[model samples]
Target: MNYGPLLFLGVFLTLASSWCGLVLIPQLQLWKSGGLEAVKLEKTGEFYPPMRSGLAEHGREVYRANGCIYCHSQQVRPKGFGGDFLRNWGQRRSVGRDYLRDKPVMLGTMRTGPDLTNISLRQPSASWHMLHLYNPQITSPGSIMPPFRFLFETRKIRRMRSPDALDLKPPFAPPPGYEVVPKPEAQLLVDYLLSLRAVTPLPETE
Candidate 1:
């Protein structure tokens, strides 16, 4: 008795069930739960996961173009899994709806740097972000993250210094009579980084 057909049917059934359980079922559940839509807040009458601004949207492109995703991740692990809550990477566990507005969803796999899920809320200072981008060492001592100095330009100071100029000190600062200022791309990238916030509570994730 040839069991080739029977064996093939069994293997196919097993793979099909695995796919259904792993992928199809979760997708169906998400759709059914209305998890893809923007949630409405009863008090403010505003929606959660607010819409992305034009600058932040452009900044997101800059973030991707600069390959920041390779080192920094945007996902926060749940409790008992990786101690993400203890680390204060996020106020709550990340969920599908948290990424509904993200076009590519930068849930990076590597952890060369800290998770950036709630960076905006954690470090809301734009100047701090500017310095970190210009040179990680200035902000974070002994940081392995490379400086994106090319994003800025050293220009001779005219009548006065530009307000957007990086307030560098000592070796990080440029020579006298000159100041380092972030270009458009650098500002956009910082804007994108400053926009990364996922602290809102969701019914499913909470």
Candidate 2:
């Protein structure tokens, strides 16, 4: 009595069921719930999760290119699931609809840095983001996040300082006659970072 055929059948069923439960069923449920559709905000009557566009959209490419997703996660853990709520990472847990606009959603795998689902709301200043990108330690002392100095250029000031130049003091500052200005990619990356606001309240997650 060979049990090989029975074993193979059992394994196949197990894998198929796992795939259906993990992927297929969730996708069908998301579609049924209209996760792709933008819902109206109850407060302002405006649309929630607006589409990504312009330089900010392009900046997402830069972020992906730089592997920023490796160190950061965009999804906030639900209450009692983790300390995300206690840490003030987000106002509420992230839902499927919050990421409707992302073409390939960047719900990162690791959390080397803090969650960035609501970075724009937490740190709204563009200059601060620029400085932080150039050197994270400037804004966040003792931070392990690496600086993206390659995305900026240090050049001698002509007659006047570029308005976009990062303001630095002492150790992190360029030479006396030089100023560090962000390149197009850096600006675009900052724009994308600034666009990451997931504070909207949804009925499903509530």
Candidate 3:
């Protein structure tokens, strides 16, 4: 009674079903439980609008296409030895509700680049982000971040366009010879990044 093939098929199917039932199914259920909707901040002191910009959506696509998740993460682990807990990065631990609006959570697995959960607070300057995106090596000489020059353009400073003048359509194209900037996408991404602040208040005990 050689049951080698049958046993292998049975084991594979069991593991596959178990993995999907336990992990994938639950995740899908969680996703379906709530769609993107704003929640009031507990602190309210530092409240800003949840990312509702068209650029944020475009930036999300850019984030996915670039595989930024492969290097950086969006989640801040529970406070501990992880770099995120360090004073230099942020002052609070992240919570599940903080990411309630995220459709596909970007809690990446790797840590090639520092966690970007608090980048907006850490380096709020738009110029800094632009320079970094244009040429990572220029800002941090040792940075492993690949340059995204293709996403931007360069030219001398000139007349500024009114905020109301921006087109909110997809495939956001900047005006000619105006140094089509990455910060347009970076700004929205930064906005979303900034929005990653944990709604949970910090514990009093050290």
- Residue 101 in candidate 3 has what lDDT? 56
1-206: candidate 2 lDDT, tens digit per residue: 47999999989999999999999999998888888689998889989888666999999999999999999999999987889989889988999889888867899988999999999989999999999999999999999999999999999999999999999998999989999999999999999999998877788877
User: Count of backbone clashes for each model?
Assistant: 0, 0, 0
Q: What ranking of all candidate models by TM-score puts the best one first? A: 2, 1, 3
Could you tell me every candidate's TM-score relative to the true structure?
A: 0.88, 0.91, 0.65
What C-alpha lDDT do the candidate models reach, one value each?
0.90, 0.92, 0.62
- Mind sharing the TM-score for model 3? 0.65
Question: Which of candidates 1 and 2 is the stronger one according to lDDT?
Answer: 2
Return the clash pairs for model 2, or none: none
Who wins the lDDT comparison? 2
lDDT (Cα, tens digit) per residue for candidate 3, span 1-206: 47999999988999999899999987787567532234455676533235546666666777887788999887776667666676455566655555655667788998899888778777776566656776676668888898787666454446774432323122333445344445466656544544444434533212
Best by TM-score: 2
Tens digit of lDDT per residue, candidate 1, span 174-202?
99999999999998887888888987766
lDDT of 1: 0.90
RMSD, each candidate, Å?
A: 2.6, 1.9, 7.5
